[model samples]
Target: MPHVTATKAMPVPASKAWEFVSNWGGTDKWIPGVGPVVVEGSGIGSLRSADLAPETGFPGRISERLETFDLHKMSFSYCVVGDNPIPITNYLARMSVKAISKDSCEVTWESTWDTELDEAELVVAFNGLYNLALDNVEQLMLSENQ
Candidate 1:
């Protein structure tokens, strides 16, 4: 599967930002392929489960189990729950959030899936998601900041 990556900055404290993005269930609001999250345990090793929604090319649900995570490192990793497309399922996607200031943080999304998912197609989908998520977040931050 081809990797999809996008980065965005938010004017919020690192702790606050971490709390928002690190929550598995919280992803539905921003991520395109994710819905609600079910988490168990605690810390990075905590079990995170979520349903991947249908996108442009496909319309089905896929479950992912977050296998690794690190709050201090601002990174997390996950793998597909079931047998999926040979090329699309066998890979990992990681996301990291870094703080640039007390009120500014940047999130970097990266994945290394093994596939030939037309780079352009993946990019187009990701771009829409990234822009939508970022814009929504910025608005949220501004409203909260006020």
Candidate 2:
């Protein structure tokens, strides 16, 4: 199993950050070249499919299912379903936000997956993606708060 985690501090309230991150269907807004997310069902157990933009150089569609959701806890768990472009299987990920202060928050994204490929390589790749996404979120939240 390969596991990776990425955490970033955002200059925004936890509530504001959570509202952005918890939108299971709105990932395209902050995940860079990912967009056109289509979701089925709702809440926990809902399924979402996202298409990676062709220019991203890593184009493919990813499907995921919400395994758990807790608005009160500002956290959620999801599992990748069906075929994945990434060379991994049984992928499970969790995301959470914690308040560092009234004006700031910390967000963490972590995942574990089974992979036959190089674990270290995958860890770095996943970490990069998570961190980039978090960075995008932070920028958007700050702009909104201004």
Candidate 3:
């Protein structure tokens, strides 16, 4: 299994960050290139499908299922269930937010997946994707505060 991790510190409280990221269905609000996400059910076991914008060059839909959700811990884990846009298998990702200070927090997003492609190649691609998403999160949070 190959893994990729992207971490970023955002100028937002942990509670505020959790309130947004843990929503699961609200990914489009912060995840760049992702369109509206449609979700079924609520909390753990919820299923979600989101489409990638055509301009992002990865135009397609991907579906995922929430596997673990922890509110107090400000973390969640999910598995890709169908229409995987990425070239990987047995994909599982965990995202968590940790309080850094009274007004800031760190978010870590990590994923492990099996792929036939060269590990180095996949890592670079996944790293870019995850980092872009994390960057968007910071931008969104800051903009909201302004």
lDDT leader: 2
lDDT of each: 0.67, 0.91, 0.88
Better of 2 and 3 by TM-score: 2
Give per-residue CA lDDT, model 1, range 11-99, as digits (tens): 77777767766777566676656667676666554555555555534545555677778878888887665655223646676777899
Q: In what order do the candidates fall by TM-score, top score first?
A: 2, 3, 1
For candidate 2, lDDT tens digit of each residue in 6-67?
99998888999999999999899988789789999998899999988777656899999999
Residue pairs with clashing backbones, model 2: none
If both were scored by TM-score, which would come out higher, candidate 1 or candidate 2? Answer: 2
Residue-wise C-alpha lDDT for candidate 3, range 1-146, written one tens digit per residue: 98899999988999988887788888988777889999999878889999988776668898999999888888999999976766778999999999999899999999999989798988887799889988888888788899
Which 10-residue window in model 1 sums to the lowest lDDT? Answer: 54-63
Off by over 4 Å in 2: 55-57
Q: TM-score, each model?
A: 0.75, 0.94, 0.92
